[model samples]
Target: MASESAANPPLAGKHILLGITGSIAAYKAAVLCRLLKTAGADVRVVMTPLAKQFITPLTMATLSKNPILVEFFDPENGAWNSHVSLGEWADCYLIAPATANTLAKMAGGIADNLLLTTYLSARCPVAVAPAMDLDMYAHEATQQNLRTLARRGVHIVEPGDGELASGLTGKGRMAEPDRIAAFVGDLLREKKKSLQGKRLIVTAGATIEAIDPVRFISNHSTGKMGYAIAGELAGRGAEVTLVTGRTSLPTPAGVERVDVLSAAEMYDAAVRAFDGADGAVMCAAVADYTPESVSETKIKKCDGDMCITLRRTRDIAAELGAHKGSRLLAGFALETHDEEAHAEAKLAKKNFDFIVLNSLRDAGAGFRGDTNKVTFIDRAGREELPLMPKREVAARIADKIEKILK
Candidate 1:
């Protein structure tokens, strides 16, 4: 029996149902099963009939220490393998090497095989790591199927970009076994209802102010930080409204996204969302100014330099702060100089419960990066955090939010 303790990993004592499909990536399933077992999980594998051709069941069964199931009934004994029982027995059902075929079947609720049948009956959280050729993975149908599964609360362990079996170099490779295992572990670890019953507004990305049909002004904010924060909040069971500017990032799981282009549009959406929200995280790098008059057509180069007047755009955080009555609010300040002082000032000025500060001078702690180093400033004091991934930073911010709400 697995023991539960801080020393024990999150997957300890967890029941993991591993699903394998027909793909060249099926060979990786053996390593994945071993990794899950090493993490203290009791793993049982279910495979599609076609998958056995790529990787043998004997290999997986040895690693998992459990019999591999591929059919509904035992041929010799005539005893049925209950899909419903398998689904309910597991804590999480993870389908690695999820081929385009399997994804399509899952999206359409077509359960011709034991794996698909078990997937349909799974009461626990489901995750998939897709593997296919670049073109097939990029197909509209496959993308739609992935989107459908995502919308239905299925976790997607996004495939990596690399050489494909088709001699093409691009995305569609299944994530490595270690990464997949770690993702499952993290999912289980953070799957708590800390922020349950709370509604939150998270503003993200850089708002684009149009100067003309073709010309516009925008910042380098990729909306990553805001998206991370939104994901963290949603993961913690908060009802999140992500008011975002133009960004290529997909909407985070369990978040309701409101797309806006200009600062005015963001202001409108943020204000509307904040009306009923328990709090708001002002993470967007909203444009401070916009062209006074947007030209009807693109302005052509003239002999001399032409000037465009600029007007102050709405201050979303300040406006929301004015109306924040006993509500929790958080703000972010990315500064080049006097970061702590500036953050403290904003904390008071915006009526924020706390303000997160990061300096551009700090390497790997700014826009467009996956990591950040931050300082949390509040009336009580300041807590400086070491450089960490944006997701971890978001979790820390959520932790502070939880304390404030309490």
Candidate 2:
């Protein structure tokens, strides 16, 4: 029987195929192998021919508790190391110390060795941790190759910036063993389709209200929270529609994005998406007012102070709430004073199933930041959450959505 500690690990019972490539960082593969094993994964090692020179097969074999594979067949016995079988058995394929040469080959679909062949055959998710000299890592070709792999759904553990084997310092160092192991564990955990068959709408970023052709009023919201929620929903198999304002964030995987610039535009898109959605997360920082009369051209710089008229924009959440019927609706409140009161008011006013409340006075709790301290408020009561990463907050929100859906 497996030990309690071993069985309780995040990677427990998972089969991991670790690929090593030719690089000075190949020596770190031994440590990575050990970490994966310690996390209760059944690890098997595959190495390129040149990788053997940097890290001995015996070292990897001892750590993995399995023979390292380097060729298609054993020279002495003619026994085959079947790539197909390896591919089928693994829950994840991790290529650590993935050299620039190997990355290019992977990008080009070159299967010249056992490791590459296994990668081509693998049915599981593939993750790569790149390692190379600073210049090589910065080269446009390498960047393009990495982008290609990313577009094909390969998980990339971005290289760290530090001293390289070439006696120079810059980005291209492979991530540490512990970090790599944790990333693999996370990748596997995210594969669970907990939200399958559900459709969701997420509104994100700060809506722009134009005052002139070049000048617009917006907020500090970067759409990080909303984007994270959308990503989390999509990861759990929810069909997500992201209704977003101006932000540079890429669309999350498996999400349909509808771009909008103004509060009016967002209101239109959100309503349309919400009609077919199982739930809606109203996370955008929308402008409450717009210029009553927008100037067609840029306003001239005048010595005298100018006054512009303002009008209230349409309330997207309230409109959706009125017509929600059986659909779930979640709203966010960013407050500075009387946080709980404001949140409860919004929760009641918008008829939200629950409202996520964050105080701007609390450090790292709102807008343009990566962390948040929030409270989930409903008619029953409030559940306060500690300060945490925005992604984790998104997960908690997703958990609530899942329960309401069920």
User: Which candidate has the highest TM-score of all?
Assistant: 1
Candidates' TM-scores? 0.82, 0.75
Hey, what RMSD does candidate 1 come out at? 3.8
Q: Which digits, one per residue and each the tens of the lDDT, describe model 2 over residues 1-406?
A: 1223553877788999999999999988988888888788999999999998899999999999999999999999999999999999999999998999999999999999999999999999999999999999988889888867865778887677788899999889998887788778778873679899999999999999999999999999999899889988988999999999987665666788899999999999999888777989999999999999899989999898999899999999999999999999999999999999989989999989999999999997898766899999998898999999787899999999989899
Worst 10 residues of 1 by lDDT: 1-10
TM for candidate 2 is: 0.75
Evaluated at residue 273, the lDDT of candidate 2 is 88
Q: Which regions in candidate 1 have their CA more than 4 angstroms from the true location?
A: 1-9, 22-27, 71-82, 99-105, 108-113, 131-145, 158-178, 189-192, 296-306, 336-338, 360-363
Against the hidden true structure, what lDDT does model 1 obtain?
0.92
* Position 318, candidate 1: lDDT: 93
lDDT of 2 at 34: 82
Q: What is the C-alpha lDDT of each candidate?
A: 0.92, 0.90
Tell me how many clashing residue pairs each candidate has.
0, 0
lDDT of 1 by residue, 36-134 (tens): 888889999999999999999999999999999999999999999999999999999999989999999999999899999999999999999999999
